[model samples]
Target: MNTVGVRGYSLELRTRIVALVLGGASPGEAAKHFSVHVDTVKSYLKRHHQNTLHIVAKPTGRRRTVMALHEQQLLAQLETHQDATLQEHADMLETITGLKISYKTVDRVFRRYKITHKKNTGRQRTP
Candidate 1:
C-alpha cells in the first residue's frame, strides 16, 4: 500500500516488455532495454500467456462501510451526546443520513478514529 518508491509499470511499457521477450529477445535483454528487472519482464510474459494482463487495479481489501461518508457528522453528534448509548447514536446517525445503520457500524467508525468513552474528556482526536 505504501507506493513511495514504486514507479508502477504502465500497460504500454508492459506490452513492449512482453513483446520484446516474445520476439526472440531474452528476458534479460528486454529488461535491460526497458530498464526494468528481468523478473518484471517475466511476470509480464506470464500474465500475457495467461491472458490476464487486461486485469487492472482490482480492489485489495474490504469495501468501506456506508458509514464512512457520515464520519464528520457522527463525530459532531458524539461531541454533543457523549452519554448516548451506541444504539442511540446509531439511531441518531440513521436520522441524520436516512440510512439503515447499526450500533456495530457506529462502533467500527469510533474504533477507527480511536473515539474515547465517557470517561475521557479529551475524547476527540486533535486534528
Candidate 2:
C-alpha cells in the first residue's frame, strides 16, 4: 500500500486490490494482503463499479463564493476605487450581484486572478 505521493495510495495498487477482490479474493483477504482497511478496498471496488474511481479523489473543502463572472466586476471595482478596503469591496460586489461574499472571499478571488491590491497598514510615512 505505498502512496503515489504524500497523499493517497498509488493507482496501480488500488486497481490491483480491486482486481483481487473481483477475481474471487475476499475484501478482507485483499485488505490483509495489501495492508489496507477492508473499507478502503470495498470503496475502491464500489468506485470502480460506479466509474468514479480516479488516481486522486476530488478535492474536499469549502467551495469558493466568488466565481468567474465576478472576476471582471471585482477588477473594475479595484480600478475605480483602489483605496477601498476588502470588506467595502465585498459589500459593493454583494449589492451589485446580490450574492453574499466576505472580505476574505473577495481577497481570495483577487489572488486567484493574480491581482494584488494595496494593503492598509495604518502607518503614515514620516516626512
Best by lDDT: 2
Per-residue CA lDDT of model 1 for 7-105, tens digit only, reads: 356778788888888889999999888888888788888999999765666556786656456888788988898778789988998898887678888
Candidate 2, after superposition: displacement of residue 15 in Å? 5.0
Against the true structure, what is each candidate's TM-score?
0.52, 0.53
In the order shown, the candidates' Cα RMSDs to the true structure are: 5.8, 6.2
Tens digits of per-residue lDDT for model 2, 1-127: 5444445687888899999988999999999999998888999999899886675765677776677788778889988987787899999998899888889988888888787665446653222
Which 10 successive residues of model 1 have the least lDDT summed? 1-10
Q: What is the C-alpha lDDT of each candidate?
A: 0.78, 0.82
Q: Model 2: which residue pairs collide?
A: none
**How many collisions between residues are there in candidate 2?**
0
Q: Show where candidate 2 strays beyond 4 Å.
A: 1-15, 21-39, 42-63, 118-127
